[model samples]
Target: MKYNNPVIKGFHPDPSVCKVGEDFYLVTSSFEYFPGIPIFHSRDLVNWEQIGHVLTRESQLPLKRVHSYTTSQGIYAPTIRHHDGRFYVIAMNVSNHKTFYVWSDQPNGPWSEPIIVEGLAGFDPSLFFDKDGKVYLTAGAFPGFGPEGIIQAELDIESGQLITESKFIWKGTGGSSPEGPHLYKINDWYYLLVAEGGTEYGHMVTVARSKNPYGPFESNPHNPILSNRSTKLPIQATGHADIVQACDGSWWSVFLGFRPVKSTKVHHLGRETNLAPVEWSEDNWPIIGNNGRAEIQHNGKSLPLGEPIPWQGKEEFDDESLTSVWNFYRNPQKGSWSLTIKQGSLTLYGQSSTLNDYESPAFVGRRQQHFNCEISTLMEFSPKEEGEEAGLTVFMNENHHYEVAKTMKQGKSIILFRRCVGSLWKVENETEYDESIVVFTIKATETDFTFSYTKTNGELEVIGSGETSLLSTQVAGGFTGLYFGLYATGNGKVSTSPAHFEYFHYLPGDE
Candidate 1:
């Protein structure tokens, strides 16, 4: 079967995979998005479906008011593994400076409350289960580890306690910021894989091996086993990979990479998950891809291809709870939003923080998976205060975003288009609309994004257009992709009214 490079698309990065019998399970970093650590399941390595999230309750993962100077500071990297009869996921929250693990009997699950692994320092942690049933933990160096290097220690899985002192391991093959370590015991040797080059253009995957679980390891002669940094293959910044063996004894790797816009080094979709084939030489070293580079397409005999499900189009909030596709910025405050209060609508109570603030506003969104797509929502809001506003938003972060909202101007309801890049704020366009309900739409292309609105009996009137490059990671400086959703804010003052969204419609363009 021939499979495309990005088997999983849009902002799902730092993929960690583990096989349990014939089924393969994977997890990725969710950054500041609520219900963190998206877990996926696949029969074939090529096709995937989101099973659920590891963190479901605020008590399990508290992200309320989680502020970050950089948009990439929330969840760093996560490693998923299956040992004995249970599945485990270990990760770190960079903004909170904490490390923890969660476990469940099933892949799609009501996971256990976070077992905070105290005294474990640094980010990007992985768990290794030895053949003797002894478990080990490996992570990047921090102030607690003394000096900069990878560290290892024996851990008691049940108690989340370290049974032994942490020891230093491989420092990496002369790359900046060595992180995302995974330990694998294959054949007679124990292999340690880590990502380096800082998760940017120079990102790469390097490996080393040792006879013992913890010891002086030897780096592979072909250091960077996989990378596209030296090529202009549309897929750039490829690294942070995880390896898994199929039931057919074939080795495959799933890693994070991004496709930049043509003729420009800007990627607004963030780092996505890509699939590649792996081969082992007679010398036992693993080889990645055709020429040590990831390709846009891969050919091999894979598990039977499953029917693709259509996840795009209209979203009607008629259910008792929000769908799995919806995510909030960080953790949402208790009772800030609701579905049961309004029949067939999502009601978002107005919050004091705006989208420009580093605090969580009343917002819920889904990722912009394609470069060219159209998103629109029917919103009904009557702001009782001057600062309160509600509408549609194409959000990248607190520092970078665009909003087309319904606000009160001179005691009259009007539509407003606001553009925010860094510290600059400008209301580029506005038009008076007296209706309580209106449809706001944003048409986004590879190069630009246009905002427009429509009344009950009116045509789509163009509000304004802005450069899409301004929201790219190159300009906004974040590790997350674009998100389009509904938002309600009162600037800094609280409001009594709530914003009600009837439905959200999305259409991905062929281009």
Candidate 2:
């Protein structure tokens, strides 16, 4: 059976994976969102289960800068490597400007606290363990103007320190900003894989090889072994790859790419994880995808298809805790949300901070995995005063988001459809509704997002609509995707009434 691209979808970017025997574990960069570094497990590579996050406690991830409009400046590129039965995840927190790592005996686990890599001065840090028990740290300078090239250093794995001087390895094939480096020893030759040309439309994967782990590496003869630049392919920004030799002895690569809106260069769903087959060249270099390019649907070698992951869109609040897919904007405020208080519903106490504020409001969201999707939530909220609101939102950053909320305006309970794009904010529509409970729905198309709500008569009424491009990275200028979520806010005062959401049902159009 053939496999599809983006084996994992929606906002998951910079994928680094490792195979632990027949089971594969992968981790992606989680910027600004708490419970950072989401870990996944898969036995057949095609089916993945989100086991948990790498950082669960605030002590391990001190992210004070999270509750703000600081942008996508938290955790950057992450590389997950397994060595000698221990799993290590190395990443750079841009907010702290520190390259640190956390280790665990199991992939989904109670990982150890953060251990800062002293003297490892660069972003996109990756760990490579050689056969001789020597550990090497390779990374690219921060994502900036000039290409400082990839740097390498001998690392003390246990002490979390750099034992050797940081040396500049290959400058890349003259690509600007060569980063996301992962080094591997294949067939007695040290192969270094990296993403270059920035993470935009020009993104690409290039390789170099050296007989020694660190030395004057020779660039691949073809160079840029993988890229989709200048092509009108649906999958763009394809780079930042990690190759693995599967149990069947076949090589495959996991990378990041984005699906633009139909006939448009806007990708509001963010970069997603994609898979491609890999083959070795006659010259010993690696070949990725279809001659250095991947497709949305790939017809590679047929393997035993794994069990299908059942698609259940209805989200019930029956669990004692939220599942692995739910994430907050940052560190959620204490007492802002509770699942125990409402029994079969989620209770969110509205905070004074709004979604437009530089602080955390009561918001819970999951990634918009499909471009064509529908989200509906049954919310019961009685607005006690003006500015107190609870409803659904399509969010990107503080500057860009769309909301269909139930609030009190001019002492009248009403349904409000507001859009926040850049510095401009507008209430596109509002309808007076006397009911305290209503069902809200957001229908996302490739071109537009439709907002609607149910009236007291149980009939749905369209309130407003928005262009999908407005929330895209091209127009919004951030490293994140769209999130359709439930939020509660008092605008500037603590809400007197808590919003109880019975359930959130999401139906993706892709299926």
Candidate 3:
């Protein structure tokens, strides 16, 4: 069977996979988002379903605020491994520079609270359980381990402490930031895999092997076995991979890569999760992806393809809480948004904080999954004050964003098209509207994003447009992508009015 490169699309990056019995479970990094570490379940290597998140409680993952200087810095690379009868996940929070691990009985879980690991001035931590029941923790070099290289320490899993001495293993084949290490005992040999070249366009996966778990490991003859750097491949920045052997004894890898827009190095959809087959036959050394490169389409063996998961393009706000697809910035304040107050409509109360504020604003959104997609929403709001505005926004961060809103200007309701690009903040256009409710639409393409609204006569009228390049990672300098948001804010003062969002529609170009 054939499957697309990004089996799981959008901002789900730094994918790590593990298999238990007939099922394969995957986990990815969620930076600055409320519930961190999204976990997925797939029977076959192709079809995947989002089971739940590993960090559901704020106590486990406290994101008070994001680095204003950095874009995506909450949760970093996570490695999920299944041992004994429980599932374990170990990852780091770059915001605090701390590594922690969690475990649960079920894949979709109310997992245990975090167990913070001490003294690992590094990131991207992984757990390797040997056949003798001993677990080793490996990651990027820290304090005593010296420079950029891989480090290993015997982890006292029961206490989240390193029982054995931490030491430097193999400083990779001279790559910029060697990180994201995963150890696997394959075919009686200990295999150590790590990503290097610093994630950007130069990201790559390299491997080494050792006779023992902690050793003078030998580098693969084919060093940097998997990389798409300096290539014209659609899937660029290919690295940060985890290999999992299927129940059928076949090996596969799940990694993170991004598809740039319009043949350029400007991506706003963020790094997505992709899959590729791993060959491990002749030399004991592994061959990942396709000749050290990932493709847009992969033709591999299928495992009785499971039922596809339903898309959440249309949401009617019928449930008491937001769906799993929905996410909030940082830590949303209580009473900011509600679905119970107004049945079938999402009610958003405008807070004093705006999207530009460092603290959490009254905003809720989902990742802009597709480069070419249409987004539409119906909202009823009458701003009592000038700063009180509510509508749809294409958000990357506080500094880089574009919004088409319904706001009060000079005692009259008006439509607004605003863009925030770095230091420049400007309102491109605004028009007077007599109605309390208006339907807003945003159509996105590879080059630009066009804004539109419904007229009083039910006709669609174009508002304004923004360049998609302005929001790309190259221009904006962030680790994340865009989010289509439903928001209400008072700029700096609390609003007396509320905004009612009736429904939301997100249609991919193909859909």
Candidate 4:
């Protein structure tokens, strides 16, 4: 069954779908986004409910190296499967190539602690269970260090242990860097579907088949079964797909692509999810998309009626801990941030002096949905000493971001739009808004971003507004969301005071 609109959207990439009876569960990669690998549940492949996240506790994965100024490493794509009544997920912490697995009895799970698989370095790890109940793991093979192709290894079904040495299966049929393999058994042939083109403009989907799981395979004649190479549209990149048969026996494919916003060609949202249908030809070869190219239109069906989970937006800083919607760029500090409804706002303690610092400064932000949007926050800020500032920001990386901050100059308060230069907060633009309270708003229209600040005296000033075509993962180079957040930082040896943020709202499609 084809969906008029896909069930999954946003930065949800590398979708792995599993069906247990009539219910279906899907998981996607969360690189730097905390609460990694958001798991979604659906009955009709159209409507999806975020059942839970696979990694909630920090102990399951560490972020010391991942959250650093020198490097950006986070968990990459993951594959989820259900075997014998137990649910399993195989994932790779891309910063380090070690693979790990987690298990749960229920799809909406109180999942088990991660059991690190015996392996070195690799990405895009997936698990395959054959008809004989034998398990195998498939991953992207890296060369210069080892092999240059897709590699597979036997896994113990009961212990989730590696049983056989990793072996190379196929080098790809003249395609560069073949990876992202999803193993499937159709009829009597074992099919391996892979994504090639190096996650860039040349990205495509191809397949190979073998009679035995451990032998040489024949490449599909209709290789690159789906791609956007023919389109002149802004959406250039596409690939990294997984397929599954609906309970009604219809086939569907989920993959990743990007929709560029004018000058903001650097997509802060990373790669987005795309959907298409798969049809088998007379010779048993698979053809994807109705016209040999992915449809530009949304193809997911409407979800069945249920008491839907509320659409996520507008976070109240009432609870003592951070909400699920909030995640730190690197590692979070113990008392850097908190939520206190009784205090009437969210309090963020100052940490790093600038955005590029490795210490996870008091930052709480959400995903940018890759379109027009308005994000606003109200705050009462108190600087610890001189040079201290607190404000709202749109962050892509430490070096690439813009913020409106209230800072103490001499004995007076001033507002500024600042960008980061290592430890220094360079004042790109500023205005003399000597007020204790302020309302800051950022309006993003497609690729352009504008900043507005209003003082308590009703004086509204435009601090710094310009085209932000610099927030793309291709440009900024991280697997994190383009963040709109509330943050604070102290200068020297100083006593810190909490910056109270009243509300943070993202009005998507704002005119």
Assess each prediction's global lDDT (C-alpha) against the native.
0.87, 0.88, 0.87, 0.74
TM-score of 1: 0.97
Clashing pairs in 3: none
Q: Write the per-residue lDDT of candidate 3 for residues 1-511, one digit (tens) a residue.
A: 7778798989989999998888889999998887788899888978788877888888888887545567677888889998888999999987777799999989898899999999766678999998888999999886354677988888988899888777788899888889899999877789999999988999999999988888789999888889999889899999999998887777888999999986677888899999988887488899987888899987777556566677779998988878778888877788898898889999999888888877888998989988789999999898888878999999998889999999888888899999999999999999988789899999999889999999657988898999999999888886787899999998887788899999999998851
User: Between 1 and 3, whose lDDT is larger?
Assistant: 3
Q: How many pairs collide in each candidate, listed in order?
A: 0, 0, 0, 13
- What is the alpha-carbon lDDT for the whole of candidate 4? 0.74
Instruction: State the lDDT at 454 in candidate 3.
Output: 97
In order of appearance, the predictions have TM-scores of 0.97, 0.97, 0.97, 0.91
Candidate 3, residue 135: Cα displacement in angstroms equals 1.3
lDDT of 1 by residue, 301-413 (tens): 66566766556478899999777778999778666799978899999987888888777788999988888999989998887778778999888998899999998777887
| Cα lDDT, model 4, residue 276 | 72
List, residue by residue over 1-511, the lDDT tens digit for candidate 4.
3443234545777788888888878898877656677898877665677777888777766665643543456677789998888999888876555688899998777788888887633568888889898888888787674767788889885676779888888877777888788898888999898898877678888989999886688998878887887566555567888887777677877788776665444555657676677789888878777645776664543324344456667766665666555666655677777675236588777875456665557677776764688888889886647777888888877766778888877866688887653344567886666567899999887667889888788877888875556666675665555777788877543336678898888777831
Tell how far residue 397 is off in model 1, in angstroms. 0.9
Q: What TM-score quantifies how close candidate 4 is to the native fold?
A: 0.91
**All models, RMSD in angstroms:** 1.5, 1.7, 1.6, 3.0
Name the lDDT value of residue 300 in candidate 4: 45
